[model samples]
Target: MLAPESTRALFTGHSLGGTLSPMLALTLAGLGALKGEGLVYITVGASPGNKGFANIFAQTFPTSTSTCPETGYAVWSKNIINSRDIIPQAWCMKRILSPAQNVKNIPSIYGVPTIPFIEFVVFWLNANANKSHIMYAPLPITSCWASSLRRPLKTWLSFWVSHWGITMHFITMCWV
Candidate 1:
């Protein structure tokens, strides 16, 4: 149960848990356990739901600039996606095939060779598994490329420090 003085509830999860967090928030809001305006959810590497579910979620918890009644902070939900991570691309046919389709385009940091046959196999498998009729839509997202994070670490730290008062060490440790 939320304390009377608590004006916000932040729900967060990674990977599969990320997929469930938004659903959990929606369920709780529907059950009247939490107010939509007082809840915020942040998911990392979350899989996509069907288009209908995404639409309902967007409508139920629309991002707003309005501040919470009890707290001055803005009421919003954010999906954080690591651009290099494949898990976040699941259930969406185009996104699922993107890695294979663009394998040659991505720079290889480790000098790993890109095999054409393997790319084709991956594309074939994903194309067969994810059909066209079933559409999946992602929520509004804050995208960051994992490989490029180190270059922007200072800027990232400053943003987090200013907004959430988080320590640089904590943010660095989490990323590492």
Candidate 2:
């Protein structure tokens, strides 16, 4: 819907798409095709990005703001996470799973000898943070869902039913 529109653009997605929508906005704004002030992004169950990407993204467009009646930020995007959903709260260790290969941290750039500051920083933090996933969230990230404990079997059955039956992005969940 954004292709032909002249007004500023907005996009949305679910799950992994949560990460993508804001990325699209960043790309568009970088190209000067979209106005940063007019752009907005709403994502559901979004995952986190690397620290480098987060820093670059934040530098490009500030995160959402409060003080506005709308759930949207006064500036950037908004993320929504379900109360019972563990997707947003997921933890990972990228380095242990896949340590850096036999390659230099920052290769020479035409012999000028420059360090990839952002990349190195991300790698350093990733290694130290156990390479766990990183993410950003808005205040009060949940909606009206209340806490309720279900039996072990019941929880599994309902999760699988709602996941496979309803076609939720539960592949990652199944991994757990």
Candidate 3:
């Protein structure tokens, strides 16, 4: 191990990194690497680990009981899922209900018990996550998104340089 007084640890990741951030945080915390302080896990377009995995994480790291994530809010780890991203919707869950619904939805099966829920799922599927996932604008409904796309190549490069630096704040800006 490096010297305890050397440098504090911070973990940042995207996509899978976002998924692993919390797991690593939990592991490091258990190992006392955090030294009783909070470790920040920041992510962009984070796929939802909010199901069973999150439940287990909560049991171990229960300092904050807040499950609700606000847009553009930076706290623990910011799991920013584009409103249109289906990957984030396709959750990793241990609940039997998900699998049961899957089996029931098949043509061979009759009907799923949660017909309404399935309808909701179908509606979401119809929405097409891929189409909206690419378009982005900073939250608070500013012209950044549209204007960014319309900018000259020179201007666009400047924005990427300024906003695309390696930082969680920039990551959040990209998502929101």
Predictions: Cα RMSD each: 11.6, 14.6, 14.5
lDDT of 2 at 156: 41
Estimate candidate 3's alpha-carbon lDDT, on a 0 to 1 scale: 0.41
Query: What TM-score, over all chains together, does every model reach?
Result: 0.56, 0.49, 0.40
Off by over 4 Å in 2: 1-6, 36-38, 65-76, 91-145, 150-153, 164-176
lDDT, residue 26, candidate 2: 67
After superposing candidate 3, which stretches have Cα over 4 Å from the reference?
2-8, 44-52, 59-71, 93-176
Q: Candidate 2, 172: how far from true, in Å?
A: 11
lDDT of 3 by residue, 1-176 (tens): 53265455666566677666766876776676665445444444343333455555555544322355342334444454433232333432222424422212322122223335445544444344333443211111101111112333444346347645553353344354
Q: Which ten residues in a row have the lowest lDDT in candidate 3?
A: 137-146
lDDT of each: 0.53, 0.46, 0.41
Write the residue-wise lDDT of candidate 2 on 19-116 in tens digits.
Answer: 67767866877777764354445544444454455455666655556466464333345455444453443322332321221112222211223335
For candidate 3, report its TM-score.
Answer: 0.40
Cα shift from native, residue 36, model 3 (Å): 4.0
Between prediction 1 and prediction 3, which has the larger lDDT? 1
- Per-residue lDDT of candidate 1, residues 49-91 (tens digit): 6656767777877765445534323335656665654345544
